[model samples]
Target: MEKCNCRSILCTQMTSSGPHILPAVSSNSDSNLQKRYRCSLVEVIDVGVRYPPEWRKTLIMLLYAVLSTLLSSLVVVLVNNWVPAQEIVSPLPDLFPRSFGSSAWAFQLSEFCSFLLLTLWLIQWFLLRYKSIVGRRFFFILGTLHLYRTLTTYVTVLPVPSQYIICENKVSGGWEVILKQTFKLMSNGGFFLRRSPTFCGDYMYSGQAATLILTYMFIKTYSPDIFWVYQLFCWLLSVTGVVSIMFTHTHYTLDVIAAYFVTTRIFWWYHTLTNNQDIVVWKGICHGQETGNDAHG
Candidate 1:
């Protein structure tokens, strides 16, 4: 009878332990199943995720900046060697013509002060607002100003007035003389004609062209003098342009159009050809969706 009772107690203990052991095993199996399936599902969805458009724009912007800097440098180097040190005459006609009314130094000082103040104010205002569209407009305006300055230089040198002739000969001496002779020789309207080139025309054109080409190549190639001067001019013009666009309420409308089509196209082409696609892809993934992919590609 005692043996039978002991067997019943043993059976009861075994039954209780069986329930606990089965639950623990099932719980472990469920956890393992979840760990295995979770990552696989995540990988499938993540692989299909597309890059955002803004990231692409940012990539393009970065490429533009790098290319432009390199080209500007190249231009400075060429300009330092090729461009003559002589000061060229200003192109603007004197609306308030007066002899000895105001000293050149005083006039220059006044102009400088005025421009400095205006630029400072404009920059302050821009920073206060900090809008991307505003920035774009500024860059566009800056490019236009550069274009104007370049064209004006050409115009001023091209039409040599009779009064401006310092010597008995039609050609003024110096580099200008060489340029005039060449132009005269070329003006005969033939594949190759006999004409003297003037410094004002030929030299100016050649220098400008060389600088433009160099700047287009890489900004780093240029000397510090050329790079800084050109960069300053560009920056001021950009600020002015942005202010005008914002005040006139023309934000991205014209600014983006001009930047993409006219200003940044050269840089864009350079980056498109040179950038690495695989690196760009990996970078884009690491930097999040907002980071651009175009720069790497």
Candidate 2:
């Protein structure tokens, strides 16, 4: 009687906790329904959380972005301050254009598109209206693209005419100074400034193309609801940017071509790494439908 009374009390408490302790159902459909309902409750409690599957991995991504920025900036500084500095405009043989147009409008347009996307993302983050935790993970991977490009820039020294014209906004001090200078130049409406000694040797890989393409992928992968609209827009932007590199005479044809190839490959590699059972939609260029997950959701 004593044992029976204790067992009855335990059963009562478990029942009171409700159907969250889901009972076995007759069919697979019923089981799935219960699982989804449980997940919804969990999501409600975990909304706005930016944690990823691996905090350490995410941290490495963030660090890659920061370190890459610093290293790229360092490259700029060293180019400016190094002994026997090679700043004379050794223009890369462009099969396309001998000289830049009157204004670097096309290159600037690409920069504008990249900046616009970044601005939108920042606004979403500040408003506490971000789409998914995965998006943040992607952002870090996106950042590493810059790192790759920066390393490429130094590895192959292909001097171009635009580097000749783009003034050396020294980044040796810090990235902040370079950013300020960049913003100032943009505000003044100079995409490719007059040739300067400090702004040469970063011509092998086009950072501009990398930035625009990566941003495009980010927008497409994360915003599935408007996938077609964003994809078309981003595709147009990317093509325009690459074409502009020639017209603006900013980078060699090879540089832009290599940028596209490298960025696309890295993008593919990243998606391969991130596609998991927990992922809702693999909505980028390379995609797959994982079972037990709603792709449209």
Candidate 3:
């Protein structure tokens, strides 16, 4: 319960008289100088994140990621074939149909933003992994969120209207497809070869919105150094992405709204649960270690 006043850069020093940020250094320090990246919010919830040697947590995260990916893909395949509520066209026509036409520009913008954020995330993750800055553990928690998002997509089968459904023309017949189909087959009782192409009718939740928001959530939670820059950009991306979903008629209005709520709950609950219960991350803990000056910008 005591405030951490130590100058060790690995720890967060948030309290009265401290600078607006964690690992706060004097303004005199050169702008190019790398300060340690420590987030106070994550600290309170998960201790294991502060240590890189916690391979157990990383492994568990990987397992979860694999399962989530398979399940999510299966859901995509299945939902594409399932029928949407025919009577329910223009779910929230007032809030949605924001864009004039299916320019595909909005959707493309959202996809590009997600891709850009993903690339940055990968770079940061690589840096953390290289520095042993609990990168894998961070990735694991992130994977958990996606997994939850994926599994929950099937909770309801509300489909997008025929007019709004954008065909995901990309045909992926690779190792991933094989794996997802295998799980799909197993999860069901040997139902194979769904004839309908897996693109339309995939509604009830917007994966695009979830990806952008979750990406923002992770960066906001884990990386505090670029708080202002990243947070603003991420929020913008989230808004644009949600709006794009509506504009492109790619998803029903509730799908995008539900995604935001679901992703927020998943992120909040996971961190809170870990923080509240030491026993949960017991095996994931590693000895307290000091982080070096090499931090992300």
Candidate 4:
């Protein structure tokens, strides 16, 4: 058979509708067959679908995430000033003994788990071919969650949830102190030296739990090559982090529960709306149009 002298190579990918021929990106050779085989391996054996990455969308979503997080940190700093640090009576913490000496390490353990999840997410961003799309979805969800949190945390500030959890002492300085504290929270989830929390009273929901759950959900949804055992392990790690937050007395039980509900619901809702072409809100971002697949990121 005579080879077609087309500028772009075409590969077949199976989507929900049916098999569709889409352009495959290859730097090694101009051979269409070779490109097809590589794309087939990625779509068929790994991800079960071809999702062309959009670098623009990913970067935009990342910007949204950064802005939202920065806003959240700002709120934390301001709220920390208005609300004095005082432990409230909560059922979960009340049931257990308040031993600062013993449970000090649990906060460190939670931070470690969260850091590991973040590292894994970065590795995935490098490894996956359709990473831009995955990143877009992840960041959009993250930004939305954090943005909502800014409202929830600020509207009605509650007293500190745990006796052992240390809040930053209110200082006599001006905006410089607030700026320093905000940056501190943004840099390391408010943990200084992984020993004590820097800011307080921004806790209507647990950010740590939301982050861990989001990482797990994204890994499970996007990466099919990962074994079931590894997925289970990831889930177990998330559970450990969430449980550790309780032990360390960083967030109330209600905060963690709200995080789980709000995070999962928002994640699913956004994906569902995007997946259905009928939803006009996400039509700009969704990949239902054939024109999007032509430009691979």
Query: Top lDDT: which candidate number?
Result: 4
Give per-model CA RMSD: 19.7, 11.9, 15.8, 12.0
Ranking by TM-score: 4, 3, 2, 1
53-152: candidate 4 lDDT, tens digit per residue: 6788889999999999999988988887777646433324533335532376787898888888778778866797877887888899999998999999
lDDT of 1 by residue, 115-180 (tens): 443454355435533334333333333334334334433333332211222221333356555544
Candidate 4: residue 49 lDDT (0-100): 69
lDDT of all predictions: 0.33, 0.56, 0.58, 0.75
Ranking by lDDT: 4, 3, 2, 1
Q: Model 2's lDDT to the true fold?
A: 0.56
| lDDT per residue (tens digit) for residues 258-292 in model 3 | 88887788778877865678755553453222222
- Which ranges of candidate 4 are over 4 A from the true structure? 1-52, 87-102, 189-197, 279-297
lDDT for 114 in candidate 2 is 55
Clashing pairs in 4: none
Candidate 4 whole-model C-alpha lDDT, 0 to 1: 0.75
Q: Which ten-residue region of model 1 has the weakest summed lDDT?
A: 4-13
> Which regions of candidate 1 deviate over 4 angstroms?
1-95, 155-297
Worst 10 residues of 4 by lDDT: 35-44
